[model samples]
Target: MNWDTIQGNWKQFKGQAQQKWGDLTDDDLDKAEGNREELEGRIQEKYGRSKEEAKKEVDDFMSSL
Candidate 1:
């Protein structure tokens, strides 16, 4: 999914996101607010993952839908 799709469906997808990344708080997701880069950045920061790993995880999660 693209940025737009992510943004549009954020409310629905956030639950899935939380399930995948339990360390991610609702505040983090709110701050991310559908920005793919921001989401990856937050995940990277919170989980201590590399940029590539964060991006891949987000991509995989989005694609799973």
Candidate 2:
């Protein structure tokens, strides 16, 4: 699926995201609100990953979905 679909269906996907990144709080995922950049930013902040790595992680997460 595409980003738009994911964004529109964010409420449902939040649970999956939380499962995939267990360290992240519900607040963190809620803050992302299905925006890819926000999600990557939160991952970078929480995991101390490089921006490129965070983006790649999100891409992988998207693939899994």
Candidate 3:
């Protein structure tokens, strides 16, 4: 799915995200609030991944959904 569609359906995807990245807190996802940059940032922070890596992971995850 596209970024817009992902953002629009963020709530529905949160569970999957939590499952994929168990270290991410509920507050982190809340702060993301459907924004791709915010989600990427959270993924980076929680997973200790580089910015580009986080972005790529998020992209891959969204594509899978």
lDDT of each: 0.90, 0.93, 0.88
Per-residue CA lDDT of candidate 3, range 1-65, in tens? 79898789889988888888889888988899889899899888878999999999988898789
For model 2, how does the per-residue alpha-carbon lDDT over 1-65 read when each residue is reduced to its tens digit? 77788899999999999999999899999999999999999999999999999999998988889
Model 1: residues >4 Å from true position, as ranges?
none
- lDDT score at residue 6, model 2, on the 0-100 scale: 89
**What is the lDDT for 39 in model 1?**
94
Model 3 C-alpha lDDT versus the unseen true structure: 0.88
User: Candidate 1 vs candidate 2: which has greater lDDT?
Assistant: 2
Worst 10 residues of 1 by lDDT: 1-10
lDDT of 1 by residue, 1-65 (tens): 67688789899889988899999999999998888999999999999999999999988987887
Worst 10 contiguous positions by lDDT, candidate 3: 1-10
Quote model 2's TM-score.
0.95
Which residue pairs in candidate 1 have backbone atoms (N, alpha carbon, C) closer than 3 angstroms, thus clashing? Answer: none
Q: Which of candidates 1 and 3 reaches a greater TM-score? A: 3
Superposed Cα RMSD, model 3: 0.8
